[model samples]
Target: MNPTEFLDGGTVTVSDETYTVYKTEHPESAAFATIQDENETTVVAEAGTVSGENVIESEPGWKRLTFEMVLPFELVGFLAAVATALADEDISIFAISAYSTDHVLVKEEDVPVATKKLEALGCAVER
Candidate 1:
């Protein structure tokens, strides 16, 4: 496989738990969904603190992974390649795919090693 370029780099740590969908305005729409744990669920009116600037609810118990990539967009097995690269370093990832690109969230503990692995794979690491 040819090595790819990553303009921006980010890594977030999440837990082993599953995330359930919360309030979705369109109800049946929105390519990306917001989720939280059952017990940790609650609604908030303030928008500035959370992403998308909407009143939303979530469980902070989990972690967040954020990546910034310039998009003309290429789906070209990016996730699988990243997964394999992370796996080679014994790091696990819980990934989410958005319209523009992919986000891979791993344990914060594994971040340094993951960075090294990604760098080794010949992708730019934005530290």
Candidate 2:
């Protein structure tokens, strides 16, 4: 697919809730979503989950921005554009892609900067 076609998924929305990333052992709770890798389990859970001695490390104060369109399975460069835009401005991002959509996480303090850069790329941002 053409690179420009990637941005067709429009209107990225920033989630109001704050998210914390935790490095921990396997979390058995199904109440929250968790992703695991061999090195550590990355947990995106309620603030309460950050507690407990099981957490080996943690990064708090993250905000999520989700692209609101159903991206085509074959599309490419969607994330690159967004990430590059933020990176150019020295904003860091943690990105995730599911079957139909993409999500990006940035430091809570950088939400405004991230949102503005995305808008400059012609993406309507809702924060």
Best by TM-score: 2
Best by lDDT: 2
lDDT assessment of candidate 1: 0.50
User: Which residue segments of model 2 deviate by more than 4 Å?
Assistant: 6-9, 28-32
Separately for all candidates shown, the number of backbone clashes (residues 3 or more apart, or on different chains) is: 0, 0
Please write out the lDDT profile of model 1 over residues 1-127, one tens digit for every residue: 2225442243333323433333433222332343345544332212223444432434322223444553345446667777887898888776766676556666656767876776676555554
Q: What is the lDDT of candidate 2?
A: 0.78
**Candidate 2 to truth, TM:** 0.87
